[model samples]
Target: MKLQLRYLLVFAFLCFFSVSFAQRKKEIPQTTRLLFVLDASGSMNSAWEGDTRINIARQILSDMIDSIANVPYVEVAMRVYGHQYNFKQKNCQDSKLEVAFGSRNNNQIRTMLDGLQPKGTTPIAYSLEQATKDFPNDGKDTRNVIVMITDGIEACDGDPCAISRGLQQKGIFLKPFIVGMGIEPKYAKGFECMGRFFNAKSSRQFKGFLQEVVKQTLGKTTVTVELLDERNQPREANVHMAFIDQATDKARYNIVHFRDKGGKTDELDIDAIPTYDLIVYTTPPVLKKNVEIIGGRHNVIKVATPQGQLNIVQNGSLDYSTGHSAIVQKQGNHEILVNQQVNEPHNYLIGNYRVEVLTRPTTVFENVRVNQGKTTTLNVKRPGVVTILNKLSGYGSIYVVKSDGSEDWVMNLPEKGIPRTNFALQPGRYRFVFRSSEANDSSYSKSVFFNLSEGGAFTLDILRL
Candidate 1:
């Protein structure tokens, strides 16, 4: 019995170990993968701050990697360009990933950095495009980052800004960190749209910038989007807000504006590296430009988006079967802003607008004012139906008899076939002229004048004319 019990306990331990191992494998911690795209072009051999640009970049970056080597849930990789061919070769496709992202890859990257030689032309755009593939698909949440170190603009005549923007739009990496090594001011403008431009005039500045960028990459940054009313109070809610990168002009975050029970906007975590342009999806979208958020903290962004309700309704009727709506446009502006359905309420920025109901005759109201925190109600007259009954199919025309003794053509009946037709028209006076297909001459045509009243129906008949 003792030997049997020993075997049972051993089997139980094995089962427990298997279950625990499976659970451990399923839990993947989020990681931050930083890829360094270093420039080893011929210009990097030039002197900056009493040392070659490549040397200063290499030593500071190597020390920095050593400091971050032990951080949990973080990985690093290095890609170098202009290190393969001589400057005379002018190789534009000379970029390669030296030390791919892996565990404890600091020693590998440091060794690779120390051995890099600046002998070829700069391929900034090509290097960035290749670095996108350096991140591994680990089936876990990962934030891919890039830090590009360059001393000169693209000598290979490639557009780095466009490449960086394209990669960001594809979610390949976050906004990159560009460390410029004493580049000329005129040429520095070219890098403005590349990423967060950091000018490292000396090795000291480069080291400090490196530390800041890494710290921000691992930090938790948040923002509170506060939409203000005319009273400058946070009262608006349930609108869409887009956080766009100012450099790329692409939307990085699109979120529905939310508020808590206390009517306060909630905080949102966002990337601290890229500057943003906030677009509030109001009736006419309001643009708040150059929105920057602080790192490692909660930021409050306030924009005045005062709004009011617009309710278009039909008096004495509620018929959704008509499927009609009003075209809303700003006064003196022909652009249609919203096609608001009848009996429905919509919100728009407080302003004057023109509302044109799509009912027959098209009732139009100008200078319709929407005040702050108030509702503007437009009541339209319910339509009247005009039914025509004929003995035979015929060609006919309907005209609106204006009060000024002028007539406006409204509609035309079928040339032949159906003997019945209907028109939903606003309350007005109209004249219907009809000729039966059996009529021998035009003089046999019959004309009738009738009045259509609101919420009433009128029928016209032709006696085989």
Candidate 2:
């Protein structure tokens, strides 16, 4: 009795652990790097809230650093623009990384910001372009973020919208959180397409916007994809998927969907920044656009991707000696989606399809319905064998006779005919015409007609010497 009780307890523990692990995911460490881009243009020296805009930015950023300094698995860096040259110099390329990403280095960034001055042009585009190199080359588990605090538009000829878009498309970092200080409508409109834009008209609003950006940056995000069936249940699995960043027009991630033995789909952890367009690679493929994933939570994205199985099988004689294939195409369009092998079951998204079996005489099935969670079985009558015996080398071709006495060409015999050959053909009337390879005149051709009454029946023909 004690032995049985111990076994049951061990089994329960394992089951609980598996469920917990799938839900919360394994406790693996993930890194998130925050690169702060501060604008120190000539306009920042103007008065704001009884203090210079540069001074206000420095103070608020320093406080923000204090809050994030103790965050585990998070590193911080800082970059400043327009501070190295004066306004008289008109330098549009003045940008430098004052502090590289490092752990426990909030003091380094804070000190650098204190001594900064708003002296030169606002090279917003150039600064953002150079910020790509600030991240490490390889970090599959890292999420890099950029928070740009600016007071002026781009003084350089570079396009800020295009530059930021290129970086986002390259996945150099998540969508940047751009906060503008007292930006006018015209200037704010320019930054709108750049990234997630926020306008901070007052010092309190700036602080609040900064804090909200920080809140968004914190947390390890995970995604739970539930591919639902026709009944809205997550019973569909075993398909590949591509997650594309719609705003950036870039494919961010690809994963194959699989269900655990306990009926739970596998969990995927990706950056929570972009709104994805999901493409499920079923037979015909299914697309779900603008899938929003939330940060700091298990973002469950449900896509109704029901699928059904298709099996093209022969009923009687399994003559696999001739490899048969079926051209699978969508109804009303002849575009071939898959060339499936005969007698095999394949999964396709629920739809109507046209299937053409590649046999000696082609068999076509139109408007074949594939329903969710069911197999649409298509059975072809087994074929009969046709044996041809020839004593001499010849050129010949076989044709299938239609009901109107017209014939469809099936195949051409080898120029060097064999002594005997066997062909698996459907039950139909066929004609064979032959001419010795040495015969150059059309009158030298000879013909023979044969019929296959039923499947599994053998028909033999001889080319008289």
Candidate 3:
């Protein structure tokens, strides 16, 4: 009796522990919502690949629902278009959600498909527009997916591409997986921008395509950003990374290195797809386009963004100018990169650049190379400061003529009082011409030539001249 009691107690304790562990290991409930937009137009009744297109679609879609029936936390919905009115009825808005999103909806979807018949004209775009209302937007972490099966293009003069784009923008759906049954390759461009369009000429191809779509919609992949250094080695850290979906041009993942989690760069979990653009924020932004992330695989992307610094060195001191500016342009094509007032040092990528200083005669420095991890100093010759004291008490205009015979109007001196005008002239030979007018009288002019050098300040009294 004692041995039997001890055995019973041990069995009970083991059973309790097993049950507790199982409960702890259970997966969290993540919602994966799928909506099927089927084409039940008159064209689907035509015979194709040894059976009607609608019949083949019904069989394949039913099989797909059955395959995912036991998938936990998944909800499925169905919408059929053009099955309500006759082909000549002109009913473009004949679309209905036969079964709303619900768990274990395989039987409901199959029953609805069995009763569907090809009747009205094709309204592909209108049907897609109505599909936005089929999914719930409760702000849960649900993967909203739309699988559109159709045999023809939009005959209702509506833009399906624009609708799909809007739906993806609203976060109501992913890029709709379009399966074109018995569609010509030439017309495939119509649905190219709608989503990942697959041209299936037969039922077998359609089945494979559907399977692939399901796998992609349900799987997740890993993405690692390999920041490359000067030697093209993956050693850079503290980079801001963004993964944008190329199909929708939407940012799906954004993270900053060394800041998100104790300066550690971990792999990112992303939806398994082929069209992602990886952008790494560095000195000059780095972009890697058309990145493919396959299921059950680790994707490592190497981004090379070697950078250097630009230090503007003023050779001489002249405090006459309030702001200094330069324009950095690409060497060959002269594409402007930086413009406006730039006084401090800044970092740039490793490339040849041309610096155009916004001064008298516009000084230009060409073929300036920014080495990796090093600073390139540009020694610029400072201009001379010239101050003119107009004691004649009249309105006057100052002009500086260059050696090449070109002249620039410097400033206009007022006539009310003894006014002063200043000019920051480049270090060269310049002819200064001044025109003055006495109270309501004709004007008189005078010209003077001066050799200006770096850091030189000259003051001229017009009355004495």
State each candidate's clash count: 0, 0, 2
Q: On lDDT, who's better, 2 or 3?
A: 2
- What TM-score would every model get versus the actual structure? 0.82, 0.84, 0.69
* Higher-scoring candidate on lDDT, 1 or 3: 1
Quote model 1's TM-score: 0.82
Residue lDDT tens for model 3, 261-332: 453457878876436888877645788898877655677777787877888766543454656778887688
Candidate 1 Cα misplacement greater than 4 A, ranges? 1-30, 41-55, 84-94, 114-121, 137-141, 169-171, 244-252, 273-277, 288-295, 316-321, 414-423
RMSD of each: 8.1, 5.1, 11.2
What is the Cα-based TM-score of model 2?
A: 0.84
How far does residue 241 in candidate 1 sit from its true spot (Å)? 2.6
lDDT of 1 by residue, 1-465 (tens): 999999999999999999999999999767888998998888888887888888898899999899889989999899899989999999999999999897688888888888888889889999999887788876769878999888888888899999998988777887888988887788877887888888877789988888888877777788998999999999999999999986567887999999989887888989887789999999988999888776767789998999999999886444323678899999999999989988889999999999998877678999999999899999888878877776567778888889897988877877764657677888889888987777799997888888999888988776533
Q: Model 3, residue 174: what's the lDDT?
A: 74
lDDT of each: 0.86, 0.85, 0.80
Q: Native-vs-model 3 lDDT?
A: 0.80
